[model samples]
Target: MPAFDIQTARFNMIEQQIRPWNVLDSGVLDLLASVRRDEFVPPEHKALAYADLEIPLPGGQYMLTPRVEARLLQDAAVQKTDSVLEIGTGSGFLTALLARRAARVLSLELSPELVAFAKSNLQKAGITNVDVRQGDGSQGAAAQGPFDVIVLGGSVADVPHKLLDQLKIGGRLAAIVGDDPIMRATIITRTSATDFRTSQPWDCDAPRLQNFAQVSRFTF
Candidate 1:
C-alpha cells in the first residue's frame, strides 16, 4: 500500500474535522497547517494523527482530539504578549499550540516520563517557547504566574480556585470541566481583581488531568 499522504490528511483534518466544529480563525487554521501533529504523536499511532479520536499516550493519558484542541485554542484567545500556563502537558501537542500563540508557555506535567517525552517532541517541532516542567500542574504554577492565560489540557471535576487566582486581571482560562458523560468546555475570564465571568462555549470530554480534584461520590 502507498504511504499515507501526510499533507492530504492534515488538510482534511483542518477542513473536514476542524472547520465544521467552528474553528475558523485564520491564524489558528494556518498554525494547524504548519505544525506537524504526526511528529508529536507516538510513532505507533502516527497514522491516526489527524483522526478525530483521542490518541493514547504512555501513562494512560490522552492527546485531545484535533477539534477539541483547536476549539480550546480559539476560546483562550491567546495573545503574542501573553504568558500562558498549561496543565497536563501530555505529548506536548497542546502546549506547542499554546506556545505558538502566546509569548511564552509554562506547561506542567506530573509524569516525569511525559515531561521528557513532551520536551523532546517540542524541541523536535521547533517549539522553543514552551517550558515543559515536571510538577503537579493541578495546583498551577504560582511563582512564574500572574499569567495572562491558563489552559488545562484535560478535564477537571471543577476549575481550581488557586489557578483562577494565579491569573492576571483580564486573563482568561479555558478548561474541560465536569465528570464522565457530561463535560463542558468552559472558559473563565478574570474581568477584574475580584470579578470573573464564566462561559461554556461547547461540550466535550477528555481524560482527566492526574492529581486534580475529583467529586465525592455517595455510597449506596
Candidate 2:
C-alpha cells in the first residue's frame, strides 16, 4: 500500500486550488477528505493523485483534474437521499465519493476494461452502494430511470435528450459543455415537469466521452 498523507494534501488542494475557484461545499470537502484518491490511481502515478492535472488511464481515457472532479461533486449538491447517475467511471474514485454522499449511485463506463477495474477499486474501497455497469452513457440507463442527480464525467456538445428524459422532476444534471480549448462546466436542473434551467459553474477541460461524442452527419 502506498503511504502518503492523503487527508492533509487533499485538504490543501481543496482549499488552495478548488476553493479559490469557488468550491465551498462542506459535503464535497468532507467526501474528498474521506476518499483516498491515491488508491484509485495507478501505482506509478500515485504521486500525481492530488495534482490539478489529468491522470492517464490504461485506455485513451484520463481522469479529470482534482479541481474539476471536486467542482463537479460540489455543484451536484448531492443529498443523502438522492440517487446519482454517473456517465463515466474512469477509476471509480469519484464514484466512491458519490457513494458516500448519495443514497445510491449508478455509474456507466464505455470500456469493459475500465468497468472491471472500477469494480475492483470500489470493492477495495469497501463501497457497496455504487453500481458499475458497462454501456453507452449517452443512450442513458433506462433500467435505472429517474435519477435524482446525473453527472457526465466528460464534456458533451449538448445534453443528450435521453438523459433529460431520465431525470426526475426537480433533479439536477452536471456536465462539462462545449468542445476543446474553452469549455464551461454547467448544471441543468429540472424545476418542474416542463421547466428546466441551466447554470455555468466554471471553466474546465475534459476529454469527450466515447459514449457521448457528437456524431458527424456529413462530409464535404
Candidate 3:
C-alpha cells in the first residue's frame, strides 16, 4: 500500500468522526488531536488508527472507536485536579487521554499481556500519571476509592453498584450499558452519598466486559 497522510487522517477523524458525533468539548478535541493514536495501535493495524473502528489488541478486547472514546472522555468531564479510574485499558490509548485530563489515573485490564502493552505505550508517550494493573475491573478499585471519575472502556450489562460506590460525591462514571446489538452510552453522576443520577445520551455497542455481574437465567 502507499504511504498514508497521517496528519490529514487524524484531522478528518476529529472533524468527520468525533466532532459530528457531538464531542464538542474544546479540551477533549485538543486532546484527541494531540494524542498520537497510531503509536498505540499494533503495527499491523497502524493504518486503521484514525479510522472509525475498533483496532484489535492482543487479547480479545478491542480499542474503542474514536468517536466512542472521545464521547466518553467529553461526557466524563475529567479535570486536571481529578483522579480517574479506567476499566479495560486495552491499548492504553484511552488511558493516555484520561491521564492528559486527570491528575492521576489507575487503569485496570484483565489480560496480563494487555497490561504490559498499555504500560509500554503509556511510558513511550511520557505518560507518568497512570498506573496500569492486570486484574478484573468489574469489582472496581475500592482501595483507591472515591475517584473523581470512572470510565469503562468496554460495555457492561449494567454498571455495578460496587463501582459507583467508589466514586466521590459529584463524581461521574461513563459506560456503555446493555446487551450487544443495542447499548446506551450512559453517564452516572453521584449526586450524594446515596444518590446517583443517570442519563443515556447516545447509543453504541462495545464488546462486553468480562467478569461483570450477569443477569441469572432461570427456567421453569
Candidate 4:
C-alpha cells in the first residue's frame, strides 16, 4: 500500500469538502489547515480523518464531519478576547479550534472516558486555554456564565433555553437542531436580555446529544 500524502489530503478536504460547504472564513480556514485533525481522531480511525465522514468515538458518539465543524466555527466567529462554552467534547477537535480563537474555552462532556480522551488530545497539542470537564453539558456551566460564544458539538431537538441564558447579550450560539433524516444548522444571537434572533443558514445531520430534551411520543 502506498503511504497517503497527509498534506495533500488536508488541502483537498478544505478546498473540496469544506470550502464548497461555504466555510469561507479566513481564520477558520487557517485553523483547519493548521490543526492536526489526525491527532485528535482515535488511532483506529486516523486514516479517515479527512475523509468527510463522522468518525466514531468510544461512547457511540461521533466527531462531526469536517465541513459541519468548519461551518460551525465560521458561524461562531470566536474572537481572541472572547470566552467560549462548548457542549459535547467528543474528540476535542472542535475544542482545539475554539481554544485557538477564544481567550478561554470551557468544554463539557457527558462521559468520563471522553473527558480524559479530550484532555489528553488537547494537552498533546499544548492547548493551554481549554478546560475539559465531565458533566451534563445540557445544563450549561453556570459558574462560568455569560460567555461570549457557545457551540453545541452535537444536534438537539431544540436549543436549550438554559444554555442560551448562559450567553451574554450579543453573544451567539451555534447548533444543529431538529431530528434525524434532516436537521438545520442554526445560529442564535442574543439581541437583548430577553430576545434572541435565530436563523437556519444550512442543513446537516448530526447524532443527537445525550440527555437533551426529546420530543414526547404519542400513542392511541
Candidate 5:
C-alpha cells in the first residue's frame, strides 16, 4: 500500500501545486484524484507519490511531476472513445492514466527493462486497455496509425514531424518543444489534410527523449 495518507494529501496537492498553476479541467483533476500514483512508483518512493516532483525509478528516468502530468492530460482532451499514443512510457504511470481515459492506449518505451517493468506494473494495476511496447518513440506507433491523440512525455528541440503525420484529421498532438533554458509546451492540431495549428500551452522542462533532438553544429 502507499503512504498511510495519500488520499487527503492528493487533494491537498491539487489545491496547492496544480490548481495554482491553472489546471482547471474537472476531468483532469478527477483523474489525478482517482489514480493512485503511489501504486506505480518504486516502492522506496511511494511515500512521496503526491509531491510536486519527479519520482525516480530503477532506471535513470523519473516519473514526471504530477502537475505536468495533469496539465498534459487536460490539454490532450482525451475522450473515452479515443485511441491515444504516448511516447516514453516511464514507470507506466501515464499509460494507466491514458488507459482509463481512452478506449486503448499504445505506449512506447525505448528501454527494454523499463518496458518489462511497465508491463508488470500495468498487470499489477489490472489495466487491460494499455499496450506497452519496447521500441523507439520518435518513430511513433505506426502499426496503430491514425491515432486520435499523440503525446510525448519527454521533450525535443524539434517536434517529430513523422509523428504529427500520423495524426488523423482533427487529431491533436502535445509536446514540450525546445531545449534547456527554453522549453515551451506546445499543442498542434491537424486542422485539415495538410494544415496544422500550433498553440503554446505553457512553459515546461522535461527530459528529452533519446532520439528526438535538434541537429548539433558540426565544426568541420
Candidate 6:
C-alpha cells in the first residue's frame, strides 16, 4: 500500500469537507490546518483522522466530524481573552482548538479513560491552556465558571438551562441539539442577566451526549 500524504489530505479535508460546510472563518481555517488531529485520534482510527467521519472513541462517544467541529468553533466566536468551558472532551482535539482561540479552557469529561487520553494528546501537542477534568459535564462547571464561551462537544436533546446560566452576560454557548439521525448546531447567547437568545446556525448530526436532560413527552 502507498503511504498517505498527510498534508495533502489535510488540505482536502479543509477544502472538500469543512470549507463547503460554511466554515469560512480564516482563524478557524488556520486552526484546522495547524492542529494535528491525527495525534488526538485513537491509535486504531488514526488513518481516519482527516476523513469526514466521526471516528469512534474509547467510550461509545465519537469525535465530532471535522466540519461540525470547525463550525461550532466559528459560531462560538471565541476571543483571545475569553475563558472557555468545554463539555465532553472526547479526544481533546476540539479542546486544543478552543485553547488556541481562548485565553484558557476547562474541559470536563465523564470518562476517566478519555480524560487521560485527552490529557496525553494535549500535552504531546504542547497545548498548555487546557485543563481536562473527569466529571459529569452534563452539569455546568459552576464554581469555576461564568465563562465567556461554552462548547458542548457532542449533541444533546436540548441545551440545559444550567449550562446556559454558566455563560457570562454577552457570552455564547454552542451546542448540537436534537435526536439521532438529525440535529442542528445551535448558539445560545446571554443577552442580559436573565435573557438568552437561541439561534440554529446550521444543521448537523452527532451522537447524543451522555446524561443531558431530554425533552419530556407524553404518551397515551
lDDT string, candidate 3, 88-196, tens digits? 9999999999999999999999999999899999999999999999888998999987899999999998888999999999999999999868899999999999999
lDDT of 5 by residue, 133-171 (tens): 888898997778899999888788888689999899899
Residue lDDT tens for model 4, 71-128:
9999988999999999999999999999999999999999998999999999999999
In model 1, the Cα lDDT at residue 82 comes to: 98
Please give, for residues 105-188, the per-residue lDDT of candidate 2 as tens digits. Answer: 999999998999899999999999999999899888878789999998888988987898889998999999887787999999
Q: Which residue ranges in model 5 land beyond 4 Å of their true spot? A: 1-4, 217-220
| Cα-based lDDT at residue 16, candidate 3 | 96
Regions of candidate 1 where Cα sits further than 4 Å from its true position: 1-4, 217-220
Candidate 3 stretches with Cα past 4 Å from truth are 1-4, 217-220
List model 6 lDDT by residue over 77-152, tens digit each. Answer: 9999999999999999999999999999999999999999999999999999998999998887999989999999
CA lDDT of each prediction against the hidden true structure? 0.92, 0.87, 0.93, 0.93, 0.86, 0.93
TM, every model: 0.96, 0.93, 0.96, 0.96, 0.94, 0.97
Cα TM-score of candidate 5 = 0.94
Residues 44-136, candidate 1, lDDT per residue (tens digit)?
999899999999999798999999999999989999999999999999988999999999999999988899999999999888888889999
Q: Which stretches of candidate 2 lie over 4 Å from their true place?
A: 1-8, 215-220
Q: Higher-lDDT candidate among 2 and 5?
A: 2
TM-score of 2: 0.93
Candidate 2 local lDDT, residue 68:
88
For model 1, which pairs clash? none
In model 4, the runs with Cα more than 4 Å from the true position are 1-4, 217-220
